[model samples]
Target: MMPNRRRENAIIGLGVIALAQVRSRKRKNFWIKNCLLNHDEECPMPLLPELQENNPDDFRNYLHMTDACFHQLFALLSPYIKKRDTCMRTAIPAEQRLIATLRYLATGRSLQDLKSTTGISPQALGLIIPETCSAIIQVLQKDYIPFPSNPQQWQDVAAQFQHQWDFPNCGGAIAGKHIRIVPPPNSGSDYLNYKGFCSIVMLAVVSATYEFLFLDVGKNGCNSDGGAIMQTEFYKRLQNGSLNLPPAEENVEGLNFVFVADEAFALGENILKPFPMRNLTPEQRIYNYRLSRARRVVENAFGIFSSRFRLFLTPINLAVYKLNHVVLCCCILHNFLLRNSSSYLASVSTDEDPAVSGPAEEAASRPSVGVMTGLEPGHAELPSQDAHDIQQKYLEYFVGKGAVPWQEIVADYLI
Candidate 1:
């Protein structure tokens, strides 16, 4: 009798466990299939197939990439983002996962809003977007968004800057952009910035044609542009001579290719910032204008970046680390599209904003207005005499050899 009673109890416990799982599945299915997200006749969201067949333009608008570019990206990311089915639930299709993730990055819609359209729950998107963003950077970083590590590559970048922007031996222009985010839980004031909001910084070095040669993110917003850049590994590499920059110009023995920067950054042997705005001669004014012209590429890169990926305009509501991944992924995608998509630049002409935010939506952007020449440059550390000497050399170059037709006219207007 005892043996029989024990056998019955075991069977009863198994039955109870099975019942609980059944109820759990029911609840899960309800979240997946109920309302506008349902995969049924009454559903309103755009299906990938339907978009592919009917409205290719809408497909591009929705994903921020041409279908060809999408397929290329999807091909690379399939192995990373693909999911396997389980007994409890069928895995969301890999295509759908990519679609949902791209839409989030492209549109910067709230996860709740995305849920209604993608048939993905906000909970799922909160998980999927960052992971997909990581996959994007992992798959694309080496090729599309690489920083110049060798002297040859660095020289090539400098050559492009000289050829395109007429700034000789200029490897790149540096700019800092503030990206706002909801502060992490119990973080105290650690993430709070001078802007009276919590944010992170994206310090990038952009090529003359507006490609991102190097991007350093994850700095707290409290740090000034100089501080943020000083803390970067790039700065360490630059200071230590491990950056593998091309040989110095024939005219100057130790002067290498220079990066044009604004007042927010310090002048250095290889980094040129404009003369102080207070008092200036014609030579000084010309130098400022020339530096500003080269530096404007960084501003254009950031503006067009914000314009393309409206996500940069909206406050990203994710953890700091995940937000870093998102920023990295965007930089990668920006380069990828530049290389692959013919329509990418053409889309800039579109007046249509992909994501329209309510006024209540606190905007976080690169602040295109006052960036190229910041209004009031922060007083970081004073520069060494060597740095000043470099700036003087560039001033002479701008006035003598590198002078443009209208630079004198433009410089005089400023005075």
Candidate 2:
């Protein structure tokens, strides 16, 4: 009985070996026919497909990929980022640092809260936020902002404004916004420079398509818009006559094509403003209406910028010097989104006219363009005669040219 049991076990082992040999032979034959012998034929063995679905929308849904998106953005921007050797030696990996920083910006979570979510320590998070912001600003200042390089580019931008917003020969819309920041350490009266809480000033120009044409950061909130504009590099260029803007054409009432701002910016002949009147003439009203309609591009641009950065939506707890870097980075990303069609502006309802009231009441109400409000802090009011003269001149020019009526223009182009 013992011999029979041993023999049975041996037979079973032999059967297992025989089955393994058969399977091996089959696999070998399959490989030879499909992969080796038929070299010209496509391999039958399944290959892993490349993952091509890493888009911003999809990546934004997942935490890891969201992290990766920031990583990729920072990686592309590495060369522009500057850091001290001491900081660099102790710094975390660039990719990790960037993702963590962006996560903070996007979510507005506390640094302690971010530790669990981003898997970074609180101390590392604090350092990474400022460092990464600095790097982003350097990259953006170097690469992204579109300061018109030539007369032709400026003309092209003007043409776009004319076609899209019916503001013919206009350069861009100028405006200023406050960016909240962390109060500086030992800041007393200096903190008073920022309004409400710690904050900085951002002055920007928005193009016809509601994209940021130029943005400058680091002005204290207490500075008047006029003061900030005077300090801007763009303004410096204009003052130095480095920009090749043509002299105002006689037909356009000798108004050189340039960005029109509120009364906050001191106007020479080039930058035009409407007559400041408690009441305006029909033609003056129409001209102001058109100008206001066109200038809404800047407000919309700021709305989009704030929505994207969300960090600007709330006060940040960072030093004033670091605040400048943060503002710069946000503006750079704003331009990138505009260029790439990845920004909130690209997805917004461009059809809605910000100047118009309710569309539902349109049938009952004549379309009335809203009036321009206060000038930037510390700017002189426009004289009524000068405003009326400018208005009449522009209106007559538009009427003579049979330019699209503001209402028709809004209906056809804006909607």
Candidate 3:
């Protein structure tokens, strides 16, 4: 009986090996190229030349960039993304690649859906869009979205803050925006935030004109606003004095110009957040008003980003690493459009509520770009005396010389 059983097992093993064997496969052919994609007739333009040349408003809406800006960007990006035509088919045009990528970011349409309109197969699109976005970032990043390192540059940023926001000696406004992503693979609760879904925080420092001065992303969603910023390289730079903050001129109340945030950030030598919401005197109320008002620039910048690049409004289907590339590309384009004088870009308004937090990051609403108001403090760490003095100096300035005419009225309204 044992001998018979061993023979049966040997036979079964031999059968299993036979079933697992794979023969040399036939050379595969294009499933959806010239036959399905009528590139010469239908999608050669991405949008037709007529639409771009004739209907300017609709073109900008469709692509989220003006035609001139689009042409300029293509000139820079085409070298990086340009491809050669194979014997089988002509290459997807460089202009189409740029247009398709911009539309993908602006509309958040799936590649399958994009296929019908762009006449590019979903397979080709999957390759084209990410690569083109990477090209956009690489070509434009150094010039369009550079971080300031010189003392004169920092002072210029501070001067902008003082001139526009009535916040003296303010270098910039800082905030954290949780960019929603599909749950990272094997990242058990790692990318999950207090709000219950997976995301990566975009910690941005914005100038007064709603441009990103510096931005760091990929903070685990589980961290709070303060926690996220604290974990960034910017925080390390701030600690080590490599951030190249200008020396306190006679203008800044004997302190370095500061970046303003809401309650979720720590007070530091060059960072300020609003006072506690509860039990605030009129002076403190004024301080909160001034801080929140100045911090709105960062929020508005995020709002404009989300508004123009509709991808942020949706849960991006790409992996974590790829999504970072896409986000940076969109951010660079944001700066590009603002700096590009070809056409006027209107920003979408924000509907921010510090009281409402959770899952709002993925809202599909276009006009009302959701933001974490940062009113809810997630940190209890004590600030140093230097930080406190910086806060006091700003408070005195806001009520004294730097006060906006309407601040008291707004502060009174808040009370």
Model 1 TM: 0.83
Which residue pairs come into collision in candidate 2? Answer: 182-318, 275-387
lDDT scores of the candidates, listed in order? 0.77, 0.62, 0.76
Report the poorest 10 consecutive residues by lDDT, candidate 2: 43-52
Ranking, lDDT, top scorer first = 1, 3, 2
TM-score of each: 0.83, 0.70, 0.86
How close is each model in CA RMSD to the real structure? 8.1, 18.8, 6.1
Cα displacement (angstroms), candidate 2, residue 138, comes to: 3.5
Residue-wise C-alpha lDDT for candidate 1, range 114-230, written one tens digit per residue: 877777778888988888998998888999876888878887887777666567788899978888788888988877777677778889999876789899889877778888888
Poorly placed runs, candidate 1 (over 4 Å): 1-46, 249-255, 347-377
Task: Give the least accurate 10-residue stretch of model 1, judged by summed lDDT.
Answer: 358-367
- Per candidate, the number of residue pairs that clash is 0, 2, 0
- TM-score winner between candidates 2 and 3: 3
Q: Which residue pairs in candidate 3 collide?
A: none
Candidate 2's C-alpha runs over 4 A off are: 1-58, 61-75, 78-91, 191-195, 249-254, 352-376, 381-392, 406-415
